[model samples]
Target: MDTVKPKDRDFIQTVDDHLFCVVGYLHPPDGYTAYLKYVPSPDGKWGKDGRRYSRTLPFYHVSQVENTYRYLKEKYPQYLFDCPVRNITISWVPKSHVKQYYHPREKLGEIMSRGANDFLERKLLDLSTVLEDKAGIKNRIGVTGSILTETHNPSFSDIDLTVHEDNASRKLIEALRELKEEADLVKPVTPEEKEGWVKNRAERFPLSVDDLRNIAEKRWNYGYFEGTYFSVHPTRTDEEITEDYGDNTYHRKKVVEGTTTVSDNRDSIYLPAVYGVEDSDEVSEVVSFEGLYGSLFEVGDRIRFKGVLEEIRGKDPHYRVLVGGAGSPNGYIKWV
Candidate 1:
């Protein structure tokens, strides 16, 4: 079998049968850094290829991922890794344990070639085709989530699309914004949908419904596609990834609260969204592993944030605020 290089948005099945979703581009030499997503269970709600599985973590909920660490520690300790650089225990799947590698781009090609077998797949095809033409990002987008895993239920599963390359991702978002204005094929979430979204997030984050609504309104990467709820996740290509694994070591400092102006939002759409900030001497950047905060701010916007401060050590040391991880239950970034 060919050796697969895992990147963000890819999925892997271990020899022990545990399923994990790759987190980012950087990794140690011996393993792929990922998070546990699914595990086999007799009474599991999700099924793929006749096997049942249960979800271990909730989508976009960092607190839940932290809680999951306890479960993993007790049941599958091998998946837990003590990283010397990050100074944290995270999920890392050993290279030798990988039974299969599921690349989002590859799965999407297969689907597009073989054709759709159900309603959800048909909608996915239509959505991808439209995005390819309108955004001029042909072959740059891929399907993910339950659809990629072949565990989607046609009745309720939402479409999850992944776009590779940072520039293409931004272009796609712009295209979606234009499409929403031009046609009904693509539209922002309805009031009802927004209400549901706000309510769901309010339960997990410290933000209120109004704050969540305001953030949701500013996003263009997720909404309704032909009446089906869908989300577009942007992944950075190898060329765009600047830091290598272990280049910078992060050490937790203390909880911080302050207001700052967003100076740059170029990399705000990607996972572990990074933001350049000004008007704050203590913090040079704000980094979030939580998906909710991605693309939530714009340049020149003033925002207040509460998160853990970290001291990054390398050739040039700096301070950054990290949101959405273990021990950061109250962490949040909101418009001022």
Candidate 2:
């Protein structure tokens, strides 16, 4: 069904059983290096290649990955990975391994990647199936009282992760509900309480938190995570827009009457010193000053405000800044 040709490239991969990072060249007709940017991070913690907690393959900026790849290849040489990174050989750590650090999702990823999708995500629809297919889970969500929500829409920047409790023992979920303070992601089967999702070569890869915020602030777009699909959008959905504002009250202030000026040139202009109006409150009330000047003058010529500031009004380049002598009852627009 897919029209796009399958991309093939050999790789020396550094992976955590299910979590993996492979170094390879992105094929192209135009010639460009790519960077993969994904992984779960409340604070933009992971890179694109599923290698988190460190600087690994950045899927977007592919040009700069040579050094990272070289280091990984030289590090792990025993695992006889496929020519292009397919089957991984590492399995089951020794009891004397003395595990200190906790990484819960790694185990979950391993289970899911190892033909256990039934109990993993179940195509993001059937948690019971994820349980049924996973040998360790036994076809039932083991934990008690958990919430699952499927999301498949994301902006260019968003970290995606999946949470499930099918394998967790009865004792674990019962104890989890009783606790207070604050807790992150957890599944009784894995050591880490939280973990992110990773795909060896998924299109529309997941992004970090910083990247997501950057996309939201700078790009004003939406992203998603559902089943195995990652989606990005140019404009945010209504739900996302509401999340940003954090309220249900949606209303537009109907602008009744206002003057307007449009220009893209940097030209000098003189604003006549008006009488009466010094404070911020007074400036806001002055209806005539709604949309007038390009740059308000102070003495001779010193551009005050600079930025593509917007406050509705059909996407204006800037907004009027309150400028005047402090506490003065009468003032004029001067340098702001």
Candidates' C-alpha lDDT: 0.84, 0.23
The residue pairs found clashing in candidate 1 are none
Clashes per candidate (backbone, < 3 Å): 0, 31
Assess every candidate by TM-score: 0.94, 0.19
lDDT of 2 by residue, 126-183 (tens): 3323223432433222111011111112222222222223123222223332221122
RMSD, one per candidate, in order:
1.9, 22.4
Q: Give the lowest summed-lDDT range of ten residues in model 1.
A: 1-10
TM-score of 2: 0.19
